[model samples]
Target: MTAWDQVLELLGSPLMQRALLAAVLVGAAAPVVGTFLVQRRMALLGDGIGHVALTGVALGWLVGSWAGLVPQDTLALPGAVVAAVVGSIVIELVRERGRTSGDLALALMFYGGIAGGVLLIKLAGGTNANLISYLFGSISTVSTADLWWTAALAVLVLGVGVGLRTALFAVSHDEEFARASGLPVRLLSMLVATIAALTVTIAMRVVGLLLVSALMIVPVAIAQLFARSFNRTMTLASVIGVVVSVAGLVLTYWQDIPPGATIVVLAIGVYAVAATLQPVLRRPPPPQDPHPDMVDDVLLVDDVDDADGATVRRPSPTT
Candidate 1:
């Protein structure tokens, strides 16, 4: 069969359909929250939440094994979601209460989260291999239930992140001013963290926990190469996120590579290319009409008519 034929056959399958849908949902959703996180100088926040969510995965497995509830992995979704949200809130609270020690707190929390996840999963009778899937994602294994959960969570994240763009922007840009202006700065801050947590979980199935921050940050960086305004940057980043994600997924099918890694690598590649070409792609300022006052301390000769009908104002280059 031809390569296109094989590609068509692959896309026709139920598994590919679901994977594509999930990838699209995650790709579109991640940057919505990421934009806010980037603005808040919390780019690594998604990675921390992802680490904490691993513990939730283990909790779900433990509960399922004990209660004969859905398969050990079935509850991983809700478990991860709850864990991420709680972890995000905890970090936000810590940063608020321990301003001088915030970096120490985040580092402690980050390492603790990873260690907790590993230990908890081991106790649940799972091995390193099981966590590997969550760590790096197993896109091929995203079930129908995961699809529904991803869709619901992605919608919630996109809705909240975009709907409250103005408020979030205000909070991210100037917290003290926002509070003085009657915006709930504290609540908004926590909400940003919560939204980032949700985004981390939402991407878990497609990009894995470890590499989630790349998807959240790199796209914004790529967009910022050209975008001058915050809203434009977010919108363009969302578009770049989806394009790179979907393109990476398609490449996985074509090349038989790891989806999460492929997605992230593609994002980085695009960024590299964009960064290289940014200077070339940038438009030079439009030539302005030269006026005498455009230069400071220039003694102008009144409109001197040269040979041509044009009047010329001579400029002194000296400051």
Candidate 2:
């Protein structure tokens, strides 16, 4: 079959449809929150949260096995969300109250999360394959329910992100200035952290616990190379994410490669291309006049004599 015929056949499968929809939603949502994270220089936080989320996935599998209340796969996402949120809150609290630096706190959490996840997965009787799936993503296993939940998450992330765009921008760019302007800097920080955790959780379905940060950061980095404004960066990053996700999925379908790794590789490739061309693509500044004073003189305009009987006005620059 031709490439188009293969793509058409893949699209006809309901399972493929669900996987593609999940990928699209995740692709669209991750980079929106990610741009803010990238601006704040908190990109590694996604990786930390992804590690914590593994513990949550293990816990969900354990609970489901013990209670027989639901399928293990069905419970994993919620478990990951809850764990990730709690982990974010803990990180924030540590950064606020603990004497240790934020980097130290994140490092401690990252290691602890990975260790805890491994122990929990063992206790849950999860096989290495199960662990690998969560670590590297198993797009073929994404269900219809996963698709719906991912869609809802995409809506939430986009809505909250757009609604608070100005505040997020202000806080991200200059926290002290934003606080001086009476913006609740602390609250907004917490909100961004929480949203980032959620974004990581949603992206895990497509990129897995180990590489979710790639989805959240690579596109934003690429966007920054080409975009001069924050809004444009966000838009371009999101578009790049969607394109990579779809392309990755198609490649996986045709080549039997791991979907998560394929997606990340594609994103990194784009970033490489953007980085290579950035200097060429970037516009040069307009040349300044050698005789600035003469140019200023040309801009100056004489003011009309004031109401005072004496003419006191002097030439002043028009601009």
Candidate 3:
């Protein structure tokens, strides 16, 4: 068969459809929450959460064997979600309490989670090979059930991440100010961590646990180069995520490369290209400390903006 015929044949396959849908959902959802993470200077939060989620996967596997569950892989995602949520909360609590340093807490979480996962898997009569797929991703093996889980979780992530963007932004921008404004900063911080955990779980199937944070952060990094406003950066990052995801899947179909690795490489390539061109393509400076009334609309949120005017008045903590 000719190359075009092979391409058409591959496109017509059912597996490709499932893979594409899962990829798009994951791609679109990851950056939504990632935007807030980047803004909060917690870009690596996803990585830490992903590492912790490994324990959940093994827990599910071990329990599934004990409970006679028919499909073990199906349980792993939910388990990862649960583990990730707990890990996120623990990390936040540690950071909030001021006793343990944040990085130290994350380091402990990393070692404990990964080690626990491996031990659990081995105790369950599994081996390192069982984890290879979860660590590096096995998108091609994503089943129909996995797709449904991805879609539902993706929607939840997008809704929470984007629906509460303003409030989330306020908290991420400045916790003390947000708290003073009665915006329920603590709850919002937890919510951000929850959304980030969900992002890690969902992306696990698409990009694997080890590389998930790259998907969460790289697109935002790329958008930072040219985005003139906070909203634009999110939009650009999300679009880049979706584009690279779909493109990576298609490229892997023909190139026989690992989809997760390819997708991450493509995103990084885009970032590199954008960075190289950033100087010549320089945009206007981010709106400088917009009027108090205009903070949410144009304060230009980036890794860390010093705009003192940034604040949100609606959706008071009581609300």
Candidate 4:
């Protein structure tokens, strides 16, 4: 079959349909929450949360194996989500304590999370393939249940993002000012962090732990290059994200490449193009005033003191 035929065939299949839908939902939701992260300069926060989520996945597998409560794979989702959310909240709490810089706290969490996840995975006897799937994603293996769960979480992310857009922008721009203005700055920050954690977990299914942050941040970066305002950035980033996600999935299907990596590569390509054109596309500086001080004066002139000690007011530079 030709490439287009294969694409059509795959689109007709239930598995491919689920994968595409999941990608769209992730594309739409990730950049929305991600815009706030980018604005707040917390771009790596998602990656850190993703690292912590690996431990949750391993723990879920172990608990499910021992307790027989659910399928190990099924349990991993909630486990990862819970772990990520808790990890994010802890990060916030640490930031509030004022003992460490936010970057330092995130870096510590990043290393600790990966270390804990590796240990848990080894203890759980998870196969290398299972570990790889979590790290890099296996979109072909995304089950129907996974699709619904991802969709639900995506909706929640979008809902929370839209409902609190103003508050989020206020806190993101200036927390001290927001606080002084009676905006629950701490509470909003925590809420945004928690929502970001959830976004990372959901995005992990489509882009994997290693590249989830790329999906969350790259689109926003690209949008910022061309967008004029925060809302415009969010909207344009969402569009860019969906385009890249769909294009990546289609290309992966055609070339038999890794979906997560392909998606990230596509996003990077978009960023590269945007970055390249940013300077060329920027608006030129407005024309300068010839006599900036002349606005308050009835007559515009440059005074010159001659040898006679008398002031001669000549017309300004423009004249």
For all candidates, the clash counts are: 0, 0, 0, 0
How do the predictions measure up, each by TM-score?
Answer: 0.89, 0.87, 0.86, 0.91
Tens digit per residue, CA lDDT, model 2, 1-319 = 8988987999999888988998888888889989998888788889989989988988888887777765555677888999999998888777667435877888988988888888887887777677888899888988777877888888898888878988999999998799899999888888888988888888887999899999989999999887889999998998899999999998887797999999999999989988998889878866765455664433223565656777655655444
Q: Each candidate: what lDDT?
A: 0.87, 0.85, 0.88, 0.86
Per-residue accuracy of model 3 over 179-292 as CA lDDT, tens digit each: 889998889899999989998998998899999999999999999888988889999999999999999999988788999999999999999999999998885767654444
- Per lDDT, the best of the predicted structures is 3
lDDT of 4 by residue, 1-319 (tens): 8978876798898888989998999999999999999988889889989989988888887777767664556678888999999999988787778835888999988888878887877776666577778889888888888888889999999998988898899999988899899988889989988999898888888899878999989999999888889999999999999999988987877697999999999999889988998899898876887456666456433355455767666655555
Cα deviation of 17, candidate 3, in Å:
0.4
lDDT of 3 at 304: 40
Tens digits of per-residue lDDT, candidate 1, 1-319, equal 9988988898898998999999998898898788888888878888888888988988887777777775687778788999999999998998888677766767877888889888888888878788999999888898898899889989999999999999999999988899899988899999999989998998998999999989999999999899999999999999999999999998888788999999999999999999999999998866664464653454346534466766665543432
Report model 1's TM-score to 2 decimal places: 0.89
Q: Which residue pairs collide in model 2, if any?
A: none
Off by over 4 Å in 1: 1-4, 286-319
Which run of 10 residues does model 2 get worst, by summed lDDT? 295-304
